[model samples]
Target: MNRLQKLTALDTRFFYWCNDLHRDLGLAPVSRFVSRLGDGVLYLLVGLGFALWEREQGVIFLQVGLMAFALELPLYLILKNTIRRDRPCDRLSGFRAVIKPSDKFSFPSGHAAAAFLFATIMSAFYPPLAPFVFILAGLIGLSRVLLGVHYPSDIAAGALLGVCSAVVALHLWELI
Candidate 1:
């Protein structure tokens, strides 16, 4: 197999490994909660709450986070469509997804990207929350794999894309 093929093989192997590890009686609820947090609702509430409590910092947080999301959306879509990778649940026979994805293609995970983007921006403004935010973001990525919708590489790429988008947003905010 070529290098790309080898990497793809590795990704599939890692997905199964994670899936096997995910088999548990109690982890389902935890995974569900973590994944839901990455869905943007929690972030929206936190942003709005922060804005109400502290106007200046909250405005910065929302601005940076929303900018990152806006930048990530189209970029993620382009990559997903360009790569046109099938979800593990779709590609692997008998593999089932715990939740239906918003779209068919799955190369880079939008949830993971958005989670990390929000985490990165939130960390920049509130350094103390960095550990918790990143931990949750990491869990979000892992949950995608455990839920059988994404490969390990997809999570990794989404995380990288998210952090990079956050950085770009911060830079843009500084310029303005």
Candidate 2:
């Protein structure tokens, strides 16, 4: 088979492996929690809380995180629509998603993008939190695949976009 075809096949297998492993390990509750965190509520509150305590730092955090999301969201949508990839649970036979998705397309997972975007921004403001935040973000991305809503490649793409969006947002904030 062609290289792209081979890659797709591998990605499918990886999805099944992650999904089954999560189910088998009985980590459904944890997976669900991480999935919800990617919804952006937790990050928003954290940023707002920081703002309440420290005006300057908080404003920077909020601005950077929001800007990153604003950038990530549209780019994610364009990629999703352009790719038109079907979610694993939707396309693969007998596969079921642990959580309901917000939308149909699933090339670059929105959850992964949001989680990574916040993680990147937070890391920028507080370098010491880099390891913790990134680990949490990584878990959120893995949760997407484990929940059977996204492929490994989808998570990768989302993470790449998120990091890039954060850099762009920071640069733009500096210019402004």
Query: How far does residue 42 in candidate 1 sit from its true spot (Å)?
Result: 1.0
Tens digit of per-residue lDDT, candidate 1, span 71-172: 999999999999999998899998888878778988899888988898899999999999999999999999888888899999999999999999999999
Give the top-scoring candidate (TM-score).
2
lDDT of 2 by residue, 77-170 (tens): 9999999999998999987898888889898988888888888899889999999999999999998898888999999999999989999999
C-alpha TM-scores of all predictions: 0.95, 0.97
Q: Could you report the Cα RMSD, in angstroms, for every candidate shown?
A: 1.2, 0.9
TM for candidate 1 is 0.95
Off by over 4 Å in 1: 24-26
Candidate 2 lDDT trough over 10 residues, lowest sum: 109-118
